[model samples]
Target chain A: MTVHTQHINMTRTPLPILPISLGVLFLGTAITMPFWGQAYWLHEFVNISCFFIFAMMWNLLAGYGGMVSVGQQAFFGLGGYFVLAMGNLAGVSPFIGIPLAAILTAIMALPLSKLAFRLNGGYFAIGTWVIAEVVRLTVANISIVGGGSGTSLTAFRGVDRVFRQHMTYWIALTCVVATVALILLFLRSKQGLALQAIRDSEVAASSQGVDVIRMKLAVYVVAALGCGLAGALYFASNLRISPDAAFSVNWTAFAIFIVMIGGVGRIEGPIIGTFVFWLINHYLSDYGTWYLIGLGGLAIVMSLYMKDGLAGFIHRKTGKDFLSIKRIYRSK
Target chain B: MLLTVENAHKSYGALAVTKGMSFSVEEGETLGILGPNGAGKTTLFNLISGDVSLDSGIVHFNGQNITTLAPFQRCQSGIGRSYQVPHPFGNMTVFENLITAACFGGQMSEPEAYDVAEEVMNSMGLTSLANQQAGSMTLLNRKRLELARALATRPKLLLLDEIAGGLTEPEAQELVTELKKIKAKGTTMIWIEHVVHALLSIADRLMVVNFGEKLADGEPMSVMNDPEVKRVYMGIEA
Candidate 1:
């Protein structure tokens, strides 16, 4: 008699047809938006896309990499300045300068990681903030790029206002899609498994032959690249940049709020959180201080009740992940 | 010698954790290490595994000097170790944890890693808990997972640190049985344990360490009967 032993196969959630269909439909709408959408809607789309890109970057850094950085705006602001400098001084188109700015920001992150990694836990968060402030102060002193007062991006000077807005909107949408795709692809790779292992236990990860420092550095640089692209696209949309506005700590604060309200570690959390945040901002901005207070209260409640954020709560309840990269083992 | 440590010394400020300890092991031998609490048994394991750098000494593995290599580099070079505290990646599934070790430490390809991880889990009797999150496992199962993870690296030399430290008698016996199976496969191992019976059951040779120095070394039964070992380690009339 011949006997067969049981076998096990590990698989990620099979690609859901419903979500894919809806995603395709959404992409269709986004692509055709400029044809029928008003200028105001385009502006809103650009704003939402920029915040979403920034939130995704922060989520990848802190949620997955376990590096909670409060100074990510340093790269964001630097990207804005790079775009302005390239366009006005170096005669590069602002559109062309956006990607170059992101690449430069990634290179800068390599050295900054050397400094920031010296601190651990809460000290690391504060260290990054201090570095961001130093960048702001140093940029403020430079007479070029308009210093503290900032400068207008002149690369769009020959272009029509409508055409400029359309181009900026397309770039913002591309960035949002690219950010999601990049993070999804990364989390599915072997390096992604190593990264989560490090997050769980650095000593165990090292014992398993993972290069902890190198992985952390890679995540840091990738996050900086995303933030840089967001910042460049944001200023390009606005047509102007200032040291205070571009380098504002509020950027990181908003990103934290979005990631926290959505979910800390899950990919879907930020997308849902950004929409909720945008709704509150749109309806309640007129209330001024009360709006900020309401947002803070909501954040506290979400953190207390839904520790993993809204998406996490949904995931726990339903046990379904639309963008899960985790492998699921089944007996065969 | 498959592995050799020459005058390995490690000191933490005024506290000398490992003081000029020297030892060697053959290609397929199992060496049991015994010591009282705070006797630097774990420190010796750390030095050999490169988890902690030696203050001064040379460590050779497979006839290659590996004293300056990083912990991960040591793991890649086939030195696998289990922690006393059982540090499995808490959020990952047991299968995922094993696969991580297989892919990185064992340098196996994805499909090969999966196969090796499955085999290790089955051998460790951890197949049922494969999909469960590592942190949710009970202490005994967690220890099993720790051993399974180290084994997934396919190490030429396995360093088992206190694998039988905190188990009931029956649990320790079960672990010993599992360990004997590994030994029967001719995998070299250095086990540090407070449980004397479990250590003696499988160890061909034994070494006792105290005060950062070797107190005794020889065949397990003879070492246990040594008058000096009895006086210092067993605290009995010799």
Candidate 2:
């Protein structure tokens, strides 16, 4: 009998050794950001962090799980309101409120999964959009959080402005790092493998013993938490949460932009997409609607030609399995 | 015994696909199901495997009733299967495909899953193609990947549905030889095939099913010589 040899390939990119050894590059930037960066850059970082986290969550659902969602902003708005209700009214720390918002989002997603899982492919995408719209309306009816107009976290304004700004920056950074790490860990786990399989083919994956519905539900909840966290962070920075702004569908649109440009189903895709999007917006900060037109056009081109996204393009050129979720196979 | 199907019947509204078909297999026995195209052969496999609901039937596997279980649950109970049409994970590599099944089906730990995947890849003669994306596989290799994925699941009863349908004669023969080798290793098998000769080469017994009914069954040659079986298959009794 021939026994197949299996090995654990646990080598990383040598832990970013060379660049870190060269000097403390991040240390300088981290130190300078709080002291010298303009209010505009501070505001930019807040939205960028949200974009990165939202994009990462979208990538998790559509890229890896192959569940394209146009309604993720539903959670984003729900999360912002959650933070406002918890942090300002309940007097909890905004940081603590963010996690609470995540928990709430995950809990909310449980029931929705039962309904959303019924729709397949494009229908599923549109179904989530409908659900998000329903949530937006339900929240708008409750007069507690300013109803349609929304409320502000003026309680935080009572504290020093500098203290608020610095804390918000760190909180946004934490969200970005934590979300990326958690998704990367999931991609390396059994559930992650199952998600990838379901993405390829539900029937084939089920035959292979993957619980397709359970896996999809798990991703749905995890992604909801990520969007919730981003929403909390977004609201915390501006002391204000409006239903229209917080629940805006454009959040999902922006996330799609980042993931599409960077690469779907790839870890580096969001990062690259976020940076590129920020750079483009940075340059065209004045060209209002034309900017939207150009972005929509870019996404069309990427979808047609760059099936793998930016990370995919790089992988093709480098011949590396950089973004693949392959097992740590053994040696002979 | 690895699996048992008793009085399994399936009806699509008024049309019945599987009508009270029953069978059982001990560990490592290769059971081949041969029938004409509309003979409910694939439906029968689907019923036993939990892919389709049985209108009136009971399926017990490893001494447990799995009639109401989900397909994934049946897989967890050591019942892995391959589709008639090869359905490999198109976006994943052949090795990744096996590993996915091995983790959930075989219930292997991380390192063990990797080891089992590598072993199954080599056993299925897919070592070099391990890194190849499954979507781009040639038909022959796609069939091999499907088999490897099922094997990686470490199922006690492996149900194959027309897996040898589109292969060349040599390829089908090689698959039969592979089946023999697998049978020797003590895994129970239920193979459905239209390649009568290839099936006869390895099947311990043969049964002919027609129009969701068992037309003839017994020893291979006797079943083959049955006038009714001939009438249904080629319209002539030799």
Candidate 3:
């Protein structure tokens, strides 16, 4: 729910300086990947992008819009399955299937919102989870997409190996960039401000003329589109799909953890949180249960102390927009 | 005349809060609605703001019946209100709070909204706190932020519910002074307050309500002295 409105008292600084540095780093990623890094760096890039996408989606639902969903992974799984089914059975190109998943998921989100909107606060969170489980279980029962066991895209692996790998890498990278960009843009729009106000207090927001129901539904659908597109791109890389992995709660888990750690409301929060999370996971994945225990411990501490998450904590401590929303915040 | 509410009725299970209530306000006039505790002052505000549906009534603004419109649509149509409990976007700056209202309430473009939010905040004495996090503001400032947010929408009819309830005398006076300025600007107001003196200063006409019914409606001085109004307030305050 980020909208870039112009204020009279304070003129927003031109091109937030924080994103300038981040932009430079983005250019560095594209420029330096092949020569400076090995197979491990590429793998890490994919992982980071995946986490980034999750954090962005979660932040959109919870922080600004006040939708605390614990089941966005439903779209992730749906996206993967949609691409797998299209590429294999319908003979559609996997690349074409990614955007197709995005479109279809957004449309499906309309009806899904009807059910999801019936609940409020914590109940809504669990209701979304229930919906995700239902989708997972239904997909598991279908044998067409390999049922519970899952299958590889080895059938289409013959199309092009090196190019497909690069395409997958590009798709993941694009998800990270585009999701952040779209969310920031949406926040500055009329609907975005309304959502934030509603998140603060639905009663007051509605009284002031913010259409809470319509705005909530719009974000719900758009978030689904983002997740669905990301999921499709994820499977497109692996040339494989399965019910458990595609529908895996890991997307939800990863997103929640990152957003909680990074920050909730601010635009740059998810990106910073994703990077920090990936760094921690890289160093600690070798530790097994203790790594999970450590993550749990971090969540507890952050929840108790850093209500705004890591970026919020940093902003408090430093008194600066370390990762400011581009084209906003700095206008003076 | 700008806005009117006729025969508005609302109930909570066995208790009817607003029973067949009716009132109207003219442009540039402040109408004080006085009621004892649980007398349905806030409930009426909620009805006009579109937070609660009427059991039976007609709410007309600028000649159109808006009883069926959503709260947000009401906002777009120039009906804005501040809550008894100031609910600011906790994480946003004070400026950000008003700017949001300008964007959604007035359907303003980016630059226009920025200007409107700034002007509103400045007039509300929120200039220094423009960059401060809303959650960190004091109670008086929180109330100001709420008022600023509502004002940012360029409301034709503004509703204020207990805005000065928790303030000290000087603070309440400051708020009253602001209300007087706003009233002078030609925006109609329906204010519900526990503070009698605050309402006595700005409200041209006063209506007293108790047990979901009107006891008096006329000049503030006369209504404030009404034996029935005195009995209700004294009885409830006791």
TM per model? 0.96, 0.93, 0.93
Most DockQ-accurate candidate: 2
1 or 3: which has the higher TM-score? 1
Runs off by more than 4 Å, candidate 2: A1-28, A321-324, A328-331
Give a tens-digit lDDT track for model 2, residues A220-260. 89999999989888888878888889878999999999999
Residue B175, candidate 1: alpha-carbon lDDT: 98
Q: What is the lDDT of residue A244 in candidate 1?
A: 92
For candidate 2, report its TM-score.
Answer: 0.93
> For candidate 3, lDDT tens digit of each residue in A75-116?
888887888888888888887788897788788788888888
Predicted model with the maximum lDDT: 1
lDDT of 2 by residue, B1-238 (tens): 7677787788999998887777777767777777777889888878877788899988888889899999899998898899988998887888789888998988887557777787888788898887788999999999999888999999888888887889998898888888887878888888888888888888776777777877776778888888777878867855
Docking level for model 1: medium
Candidate 1 lDDT at B57 equals 96
Better of 1 and 2 by lDDT: 1
lDDT of 1 by residue, B188-238 (tens): 999999899889999989999999999998999999999988888889986
Worst 10 residues of 3 chain B by lDDT: B229-238
